[model samples]
Target: MKKVALVSLISIFIAITVLSGCSSNNTSENTSKVENTATNDASTNQTKTNDTAVTNETTTEQGVPEKYDPPIEMTTVGVNYPTVKFSEGESRTDNVWTRAYLDKFGIKLNYKWVVDDTQLEQKTNLMLSTGEIPDFMNVTDIQFKQLYDAGLIEDLTDVYEKYASESVKRMMTAGGPIAMDSAKFNGRLMGIPYTMSNKEVADVIFIRQDWMDKLGLPAPKSMQDVLAISEAFTTKDPDGNGKADTFGLAADKGMTMLNGFINGYHAYRDLWIKDSTGNLVYSDIQPEMRAALQALQGMYKSKQLDQEFSVKEFAKVSESLAASKVGILYYPPYGGSYPLQSVRDNNPSSDWTAYPLPSIDSTPAAPQVGASTNGYWVVKKGYEHPEAILKIMDFWIKTFYENKSREVMEKYVTTPDGNTPWLLSAIFSYEGFFNVDVQQDIKAVIEGSKKFDDINPIAQDTYTKVMNFVERKDEKFWGFDEVYGLHGARAITKEVYLANNLFTENQFYSTATQTMGVKMATLQKMRDVAFTKIITGAPIEEFDQFVESWNKSGGEQITKEVNDWYKSK
Candidate 1:
């Protein structure tokens, strides 16, 4: 297990971050003193929270508002994943996170209703159509645009600057301009952008290292090596079952697994990159795409890929992975937590390794990531305390980043059973680069240049997971070690791709351009159908037809609009 760290590797390519700029040295008790100095109204010492409760004037001292004297109520909707579990006496409304909102801030969080995450969008749309929005809620970009256009959401421009902790402010700004701008419509900050780990969208090839060792094959260095290994994994029975039922690569109807392979041809899917003329151009329609599609079609014809890939969903493909019917997969860093975790669960000895996307020639294959902000936290326009949401958010950030400790983590963040109680909170937005940053901190710690306690809370949590898996061989923590340990997904992604400037991202981030809102869905659907046809059996010439049909059907106009936006920028 290569335990050496990436200190020199990172220092040569990435700038070092000063941790003290974000981490607060204040003890928990000191933080409490700063936060709990609220004026109380003796006339009403109420326990139950409601908007009508008597309270003194609200004030903020160092980005934290004083607790509501007589308690105040706020309403929101929630989604509970199937894995979410509560203690024997608790439910969605009375879990660890909700209790803290009340106990620490005297803020009662009432969920108008809870539903499975799958139904959240439909339920939210119905709620919006009926104009029954809660005081604060989590919303997608589409919902945010709808609410903003309808004048239904509060403006948080000043509220955010006042109540958001310094650490939180820095975290939000680190995502670059597009992330912060995503939550703004017409220059009003109507939503708190729900940022994601940027690396989460980039691709890394997850290969079955056990199969490679058994086949006596070296790690792939180029596109040719990948195809040759795929052939061997498909025909040589790497699983040793001897029945020829295994597959060389994992794929699905959505064609997501082919993303890395497509990149090998120096072509990107669903992104806008510059052409030789410095004009913004959609990548899928580029000439390079034909070669990638033809190669994929050849692989499909030869049975190197899953025969039913075009009909199976990614979930079904993951099931194939868990059943040991496939080997190679292309995924983001969190791949270890999903299909790769299934591999560990089904066979404890199974090993998968992350590798950088290989190239067809000397030029490296650049992985693509979309915009960072995926959702938003918004407040109703007329809410009495739009800043109340920010107050709660201040507590959440302080708990995890400022006054971090194992006791706090166990009591408030994650439970012993590995359940994250923090998800029960009404709102949460992570630092955009959290996961990648944690990998850097962990590497520094392991290299003896940093102390274990000095690393960020996220790194500490991942270290705990790695130690649990290493010392106890706990199956649940297996995925953590695969992604965050010394030689894991982050090592390849952070130390290789990102550090070396070998990754790309979409340039058109000004959400849904003029023609895009009117015609993009149909154009994207046309491309999907056409590409699928080409890869499944249609002649490679069909790609040319797709381009021609696409250009005639709104693609040309969208291209013009996009270039206009680019030129304006």
Candidate 2:
């Protein structure tokens, strides 16, 4: 699930982990990030120019890898996702993608064993503990370090330089050096990072417009308005049920959507932000967070916030949304596609739309973005062709990302069975905001500013889905239109938050600090408990006590270690 994006629009998580806010246009287009440590000066689109210098048996004169005469065979692990259906005679080993790897690059991709995508990490982890691994595979950040520390991985700095395509290099650097640099240790590239869009995780407010129209309320321009709408939806019978049976907002035990409301107060949970004194500090413990918790406390007491939120999961919240028992929601860009669109399905008159976050006061709320790069593609030590993975990756980017073609989409990317086979590829990497780029394409086509004929196959597919909803009133494609539609979540995210620079990326992009590994899980659980207590009507002073407890319980050491890492950078 970690590499979910390589398969779908998310269809958006990132938190690299499905993760999930924002405010004003025009006033806020530069990303409101804290001090970013990346200074990677790698030339954009860095390319090798030896068009006529045919190298040895493994590479072409143009600096890209050419097919080997005997074929370079590598043993690796693979994921067999249930959603990926092969042609009648094709299996994971014989699919269009795997066949192309051998036919085009002369690489024999042998799967040592295959498992469900969910079990890939467990299988990989088992292999690592046993002191053996496939020729190449993806691993978590922590696992990457373990492999490196044990001298079980290859250094890909030179391998990337020699074998990577121009497009691959560009994708790696597109989001800046952090994504690529996260793979580096002692200035050596250990793996190829899977980069994603922070904006994809940034949530927005999704409200039922029919409910708002019924209440004669103005759309939210501030957090105050949001609260009022919440109150009205909960109290004024917005659903016209004549029963006080609705919740003002959707929430869950994980606090997924509610965090958007919390982020509006300028408090970012699970992020290390820079303070006025130029030191990195954890965000959840800040004073601003206390204020936000107090607000939730009031909402909970008033029954505006879901009373059962403490017991419900995101799936439960989605059920509430579909049942029309909830009005306003804060979720990732994919909310419409998942929970919100279901509301319309159950009730044809219901319409859910996306809006940017509103400020709490004079200052705009900057949507908190977590680190987008998580998994890394690494090769085992002493593999005969460590660079083979790069050739496969280069093909993926060109065929699926750069100028995607309908022929490839039908034959290789998406199958006639309505399945995705690209996820079956041996390695995965992507432009962080590639989908947002597609959003622009769809937007341009709708505006008639760009010819629909010029858009890539991916965007063309999106256009068809959107038009299906717009023209035929198709409930099946409702979520599709909700995201790529004229005022879809991505549209607001790109046209407003991005264009106005109302979002901020987390400052701590490096791997976990030493203290993080030992204490982070416990500290996270403790913080969630404290926040939950406060949001459920505990005394506001409970936050101060919680802060004191956190400081004494290794939080102080973690902060120091975090700052040490930041300062070293």
Candidate 3:
């Protein structure tokens, strides 16, 4: 019996061992399957993260997205001239179109502060000094440098490369490589340049066509002609008002008013900077500047200037223009738009034409240039996603400026659609000269009907107008080419004639120089004192004393600084 039990136990042990082996094999197979599954899951998750970066877009409530988050929010500061507040029935934060667009794309503008022109710089400095740095600040070059040195801003080189859409990268500056170079600091992009091309015809000297006819004077062709016309207007009673109210030119010689003639004569106040070689130089210290001042002094003495030259504010000059007390003035369209509109509102019979400033003797010297670039938005140093601003910039360049060099448009217009009409005609102002005709180009390229190369030259020109510059004052005045082109010649000479009569092309200036700034302040003060004294019949030779004092006080330093800057450039 014992032997039989032993055999049975031995057989059971073998059976148990075989069963255990089979179980272990099955467990191994299951473990392998689980590992593979996890691997696939992780791969999928990584892909989703990348896809979110590329394809993530959505709308939010409040008409537009008030907060965009993946999730993050950044505070920023901004300023607007004349205040960008909406009129009655308008929202302070968002416009209808902006709200709709923002809702469609999930973005928001969180303004830390909004200042008017008067308070912009003061507020900016106060914020900076207090270490209450916002996410970003958009300011002028000098302001930018200060912020940069104070550790308030960031080096945007790598951020721009990684996040900025290719098109936004291209728009860092205008005037090609040179302007972009200027905006860079310590070999890194400290700021993005405000890209605007040089518009050839900005300020044009406007004369009353009706007044010219009444006076029976052929359109004044030269400085002498203008003087003759003004003399006649003052003494001959061209208005037949029987009062000595009409003046040769109703200029407000306030430092800022009637400054365009100073520009036409290349005699812009203290801000007249020029770039030579690679450095900035001041223009006020030039010998030609003395000539310009002397000429203005002469005009003041002859009683040909506005009678209230010293006390008149800039806004008053426009009032004079609209009220018909002024016959000729140098102004940009934007400066004159309200007054001109008001004139039309009051008298439809008042015929007003906007033409470019005539060239001085058919040379480049005849033209006066203003700010080549305007406002530019900047990204903050360490916003959770500096890329978000770049993405927004990309969107603006693509949607508003028609830039096509980014990945965002992979789905919208599948192929190059040259025939696609523009949907944003309201922003583009299709009726005006600055308009870009991109609708057809979009349509043709997408439909496989046209290649980008086949798009018309006119369309190309329109594209150039949009992306290469900031918004200009007048639709009629194209860029520098059109100003110097055949269509602009007649008007060029006309401006030259008027300007020469008033003053000569004293110097060339770049808008961004340091030395000219100081000189300009001193010269302006001198002019203010001299003009007031002379017009009130102060000794004319006080001009000589003023000039002497000017050179002695900061004037010599400014001249030396400017010349040194020029030489360095």
Q: Pick the candidate with the highest lDDT.
A: 2
Q: Between prediction 1 and prediction 2, which has the larger TM-score?
A: 2
Model 2 clashing residue pairs (backbone): 13-18, 13-19, 14-19, 21-203, 22-357, 28-500, 29-500, 29-501
Residue-wise lDDT of candidate 3 within 1-569, one digit each (tens)?
11111121121111111101111111111001000000001011111122123223321222223345333444565444231224367442454323433553455556677655567667777776786776654555566666667766777777766655556656553223544554566667766555442222234555655667777877654554555766776666656678876666656645444454455455555444544554434454444445555655666666667757677665666566666666666653322333444444454444344344432233433444333333233455666655555544454444433422222222221112221112111111001111112333423443577664554323333323322222443332222112222222223333443335332221322233465565666566666677567545666566567667777876666656656544544
TM-score of predicted structure 2? 0.87
* Ranking of all candidate structures by their lDDT, best first: 2, 1, 3
What lDDT does the true structure give each of the candidates?
Answer: 0.69, 0.71, 0.43
TM-score of each: 0.77, 0.87, 0.59
Tell me the lDDT of model 3 at 396: 45
Give the least accurate 10-residue stretch of model 2, judged by summed lDDT: 33-42
Cα lDDT tens digits for candidate 1, 1-569: 00001111111111111110111112111101011001111111122233112112123545444777688899998776554577899998898778877876788999998876557677888899988799988776677778888999999998887677566677677656666776776677888876544543377888889999999999999989889888888999998887888888778787767788888899988888999999999999999899999989988888888878888876687789899888888876657655578788898778988888999999988877655655788899989888788777666666544443445544555444545555565666555455676677777766778777676444665665665677788787777677667776867767887678676777776657777898889988999999989888999999999999988988888998999877766
Report per-prediction Cα RMSD to one decimal: 11.3, 8.0, 24.9
> Judged by lDDT relative to the true structure, which candidate is superior, 1 or 2?
2
